[model samples]
Target chain A: MDHSSKRGDRPGVSRRDFLRGTGAAATAVASLVKVPGVEAQEAKSGADVVAIGPGPVKLSLEVNGTTMTTNVEPRVTLLDALRNYLDVTGCKKVCDRGTCGACTVMVDGKPIYSCTMLALEAEGKKIRTAESLIDGGKLDPVPAAFVACDAQQCGFCTPGFVVAMRAVLDANPKATPAEVEKGLAGNICRCGTYEQMRHAIEDLCKAGGK
Target chain B: MDNFVYYRPKTAEAAVGLLDAKWGTAELLAGGTDLVSLQKQYIARPKKVISLSQVQGLDQIEQSRGWPMTFKIGAGVKLATLAASSALRGSAAALAQAAEEIAGPQIRNMATLGGSLCQRNRCWYFRDEQSPCLLKGGDKCFALDGENRYHAIFTQGRKCVIASPSTVATPLMVLGAIAQVLSPKGKREIPLAEFFKAPTGPEDREHVLAPDEMLLSVSFSIASDKVKSASYEVRQKLSSDWPLVQASVAFELDGGTAKNVRIALGHVAPVPMLSAEAAKAIEGKPINEETAAAAGEAATSGAKPLSQNGYKVRLLAVAVKRALLTAAGAKKYWEV
Candidate 1:
């Protein structure tokens, strides 16, 4: 409302006015702002920084048991980083928008969405993708139980769901189908495999998450 | 596809410096669950992406010493990590449940706590991956007149209709959590409820985060044992989804009577909707079905839901009652 501010009679304080007023105010307020990095230095220890390229980043993954690393584009997801860069294509890439769990992987023994992960951050970190579930080309007991319980259909979302179920079974060793459903609730099988997946976890419970 | 620069800093100060240097043009990339997807969809085409993944200790979850003894969670902590965290198991169990319900394991692994709290809206028109919606500096907020089934009910009159995308923070707000932010200028803390901004006027910012600021971490204290909490999500399905309506309650108990109750409902409102009226309904009273139902009714009082989302009223009511009853010790360990 102040015509003295010639920034076209700006509705609020124009950028120029903001600078005039808050420039002085910013200094006093600035000191009150807490930079916690100095006090909380222990949080980030031995951090690694890899340049995500004009192309891809130089990414490495000790997936399952195989230690693999490669250069990938900055836009590449961990799912794509594995499939295209390292050829550990066990984790699928369906519904790349994250509604589906087709790109589930394990980082440092915890479940994560591979499609949403950046490959550069995986450097020096232990990661286990869905491909790790198979030993010497043999599927894991959970996956075998999946076959027994008929947990999958079409096999597109199978690898991702398998890895997700693996994390669940690992976290809750003696889970009921109800717990399995809750743990794996983040995953989606467009083919309506929820019932079978539940049964498979139940079968695993019978066999002791083996 | 234009080239975008990515910087991964291991500390909050470094991220703050990077953000302050660039100011309004730059963005802090956490979890990449939303930022990267937005990039892929071409919704947010920032020139600089300051990644919080490497920020040294932003991913930690620890308990702090105090009179009430608070638990602090770093911003870079993952949803899956939060869900499986032993620290939040009893006091903030609703937050843990919400964290678990965000997406599938894949996205949870990559998405950080701050990212989900600070993530942009998922409105279809806004995320067209092509069309210039209102949030992208476009003139008309497509949700104003477009398909707005998922739009907000409480605060959105027509300007910005994007529902907040955070699954954990809503519960945090109900539990009265505090967010700590760091900037090149310094640091500031605000209540979780006050952190999110109402998109009423022309300014399109979703949260109160300064252009030069970065969310360093969040900490809040609860009764730990007396406060019982739970999250209720009405998703289309167990996995393939975000909840249609999510409600969480953190209630203090006194000989089966609710005391100092906190109620928060998400997805149905623009930001996390806190109901003082709902809280008062159960405060100093026995948490019975009638009272829980009344609390639910009070929570959803005066809902201005959109055409398709009128269903949220009932859904939120159920969730509120369930959460309240659960928090008041009516149920334990969720009948799973």
Candidate 2:
């Protein structure tokens, strides 16, 4: 259980030793007072270890092709970080828990529940929210299809459904209706818009060229 | 969620170093599907949170060549990757099928193998922060007398009746997988069958991992090309809901007979229960309607259902029969 003895057997310098070597003048106060970005910068500089805070730490997120910097605690979720701090509020918070896919977003081209992921874990990765579905003011084919078929009622679940459907179509544009349905099984439409959603899926599948 | 200090270690050794020796003071965060929810509910309030995301080489699936070629899957591998892995589809199809049926696309994209295996049971009383159930160090189990529908039918003398929630553990138990764990001392290997345990007290967890130890990877071997496996889950709805009862079966087929059959059931017991009686009914016999039916009946031999969960006993039987039929690639009775 005593891990300190085994740290010397490893090849690289321990995190404590590295911290000690970095600031000799502030050795007494350095361990007690944690600097916000010092250890994180060392981690990015290829250091073996990084320790951030019980307090707010500097966080940089590449969201919608823009790098936004902020400071937040580790407990903040990616959904909260996007909606509260970064001012990118396309992803809605319905269930807050991961059950309802109301907070779906794409991380590194895969659809995930943003509420279940930490903002710190999303660093150095590409994040795409429902806001990214438009290009040059033109709606993506998935949302356009939803609009044409009137696939939404209250519009609460639309953003998550659109992002999730876009992911399926982006992965396979020629995906069958069954494939799309399987891909969208995570999202729920409590407003009973599933019948209309099927029409939208059918239209998209028939249009295949889109 | 309560705020905690975070440490992102780049190595497995460093991650273990960051763990506190005392339990309940620190927790390892990997794909926070369960931990975040627990934190929000105040069920878990660790002072230190060690993230395994920054650790190198914990996300790769590698195969080793030997007498029985083994596949080693890192604990951090996502459920989506597991469901789509061609390597697993050929050798461990049951595991792939279980992974595919879990939750929905969004959850599968974020939840990791290690996180799923280590997640807590879904009993509402245990989850409610104010309930103070037996699992939470209280005097009584709320599920035992109140709202006993989702409680376990096969109690096996355990006080807590919360059913096992991991769909993946059922298939892994049937495959005889091995868990590789890294502690502050070093590394050790534990068989999947021995790794899971029914909690005997308030302090016991579903698994035997120490607070200072972490699950590194899981490795399972296919004995031969004749191995066939499949998993079947019975749920109230086809969408994103936990299975009412699930069964996974694995066995090697000789010319016209089944050999070494293994059956594991979930959501019916505290841990994924391996049914030797069910396997015995099918061993050395050709898989057919009669044999599979007999195996199904044998699977629920010792069940002692609670007040409202007697229906689950029948569902567990049907799940076993269907899993056996699916593994053999035989005609499904329900479909016919």
Candidate 3:
């Protein structure tokens, strides 16, 4: 809904000039083909908020097997909604920058970072988190293995890894140590629990007996 | 973090038209991996945010007779999807490998090749609001004498010390591809090799596209002859984080001897750079350990790492060697 990422208006220096002249000689020949897909935008600028049709709307998100509804700003990130509004605090907020996988969640059977995802972007989609690891006070195997294998030290990054490992294990129960490592590469354990995490996933495969 | 208006355009023109109306103040959001980081670091605070996610036909990755023997990947295509794709996983495996190695699955899910290529510098000075690096038009580049490890040695000049962050473009450079852009004015298709810019300028620009333009898609036409390609990346670890160094090697075999060797180095220069001289050094050689080792040496022969990043120079060599083996149909890493 916002195009702020396209502007090179950083502080001090004007990156617009830097980004333009850097790639010269190649962009000389150009053509424009107008194919309509996006909503017809009002041809105006400098407005702080542009409401194309309807104003702000209330919505519901079924997170961690619970239907939670709230009024969300267009700019609200899923992480912000989960942390500040809904209080589903299992997803850690470390490295609020998208580089860290501390806020990973599953939407429609695929894993994606909630931090980078806009709150409204994932509307009506299935959302899962580390909070879903326990069923009726029973620990899920992947998470149970994480605790048994001591795959966590601080417990902050553990939830992110558990969600990611669940996705990997769902697809490949016998995923090798390398596969496990690659699968969880997005999830970072600051306490250096990599070896234990690998063992945890390996133990899950062993228990599956496949 | 500046207060801004955000708009979502569902098509290439809608995205371009939004850029046209808010030309100077608008920013494009594809994956937000680079832009969000830049915003957090206060490097870019665009007044307007336009989304390319809902744009149809721009996210398609398929082969059709309308285009040549090619892969048409939409600009909004996610890196994770590209990595997991079986067709891409095999034929254009190097690009897939590079895509998979970026940040992590979540980042790959959000990050796109088009966004990664057009992203701003990951340099600390450029990103941090505190520093006034030359790329920001300040006098001193901190990487000149400061913590210069990840900065470029090959394309470094007096202005900037940042390295290009796209792992996808390195393999694209080897694949003989072109990037298509649509703006309010018109559309233009530029060769992938010429789309990037050097940082050795007072203006400090990176790509050839105008400020009001949005990337439509990147078109890949196969090479003139049969060329096997692979890409190798060296990172601190496997994750969504950027790579420390990357190399893409495409080898054309003339039955026995190598011909038309194309070697491009990423994170070692200001742009997704091709070392033609380095590639020429082993143009007619075989893909044996000896030849690949030699090509690796040539890839770094004239490389000048920043004072602290000497390890990257050798790191790139290993990547080149492994990529050469992969390009030569080395069937070991694909077992899984």
TM-score of chain A of each: 0.71, 0.77, 0.72
Worst 10 residues of 3 chain A by lDDT: A26-35
Cα lDDT tens digits for candidate 3, B213-322: 87878877654335678888877854555688889977667787778788999998888889887698788877877777778888887787778988988888888888
- In Å, residue A142's CA in model 2 sits off its true spot by 0.8
DockQ values per model: 0.20, 0.35, 0.19
Pitting candidate 1 against candidate 2, the one with the higher DockQ is 2
> lDDT of each structure?
0.73, 0.86, 0.73
Name the lDDT value of residue A43 in candidate 2. Answer: 27
- Per-residue accuracy of model 1 over B128-222 as CA lDDT, tens digit each: 86667666667777766668777776643556767776778778997789999886768889899898875543244568887787887898888
Q: Lowest-lDDT window of 10 residues in candidate 2 chain A?
A: A37-46
Tens digit per residue, CA lDDT, model 2, B133-157: 8877898988888897987889868
Question: Of 1 and 3, which scores higher on TM-score?
Answer: 3
Q: Model 2 off-target regions past 4 Å? A: A1-47, B65-67
User: How well does each candidate superpose onto the true structure, as a TM-score?
Assistant: 0.83, 0.90, 0.83
